[model samples]
Target: MDLFTSARKEDIARGAPLAARMRPRTLEEFVGQGHILGKGKLLRRA
Candidate 1:
């Protein structure tokens, strides 16, 4: 919520592994898991 907190998060993300940095942060950004991510599926229901 403060400047340092946000800056630290950015720095950590910058240093993270490529996969970690590229991972989807939201369901809308996810793909290729239709069996579990489809409408009415358990993941969305949660």
Candidate 2:
């Protein structure tokens, strides 16, 4: 890839959340906050 392309990609990566960089593509794949965010919870329903 060209230098411009590489720089742009690096910028995108740097700008993203650490969670997004780590790779969980769906809510089912997401982790943490089970006390509030788990299935059938009021927050999840909202």
Candidate 3:
């Protein structure tokens, strides 16, 4: 009925990737980005 509930239903219907669906919902929930997504890290090293 509300935007939040509708969006969640859409996400469920689309069957988004497990990683994407389970991604950190907030910056505080994020983990160990220092290894992959941190500033000037491996992902950005290329």
- The model with the greatest TM-score is 1
lDDT minimum window of 10 residues, candidate 3: 26-35
Q: Give the TM-score of each candidate.
A: 0.55, 0.43, 0.36
lDDT of 2 by residue, 1-46 (tens): 9999999999999999987888976667667868777989867799
Reference-based lDDT, residue 38, model 3 = 69
TM-score order of candidates, best first?
A: 1, 2, 3
Q: What is the alpha-carbon lDDT of model 3 when measured against the actual structure?
A: 0.75
In model 2, what are the clashing residue pairs, if there are any? Answer: none
Minimum summed lDDT over a 10-residue window in model 1 is located at: 26-35
True-vs-predicted CA distance for residue 30, candidate 1, Å: 1.7
Q: 1-46 in candidate 3: lDDT tens per residue?
A: 9999999999785797878877787544668676776667766666
Comparing 2 with 3 on lDDT, the higher-scoring candidate is 2
Tell how far residue 45 is off in model 2, in angstroms. 33
Question: What is the clash count for each candidate, in the order shown?
Answer: 0, 0, 0
Which runs of model 2 end up more than 4 angstroms from their true locations?
A: 24-46
Question: What TM-score, to 2 decimals, does candidate 1 have?
Answer: 0.55
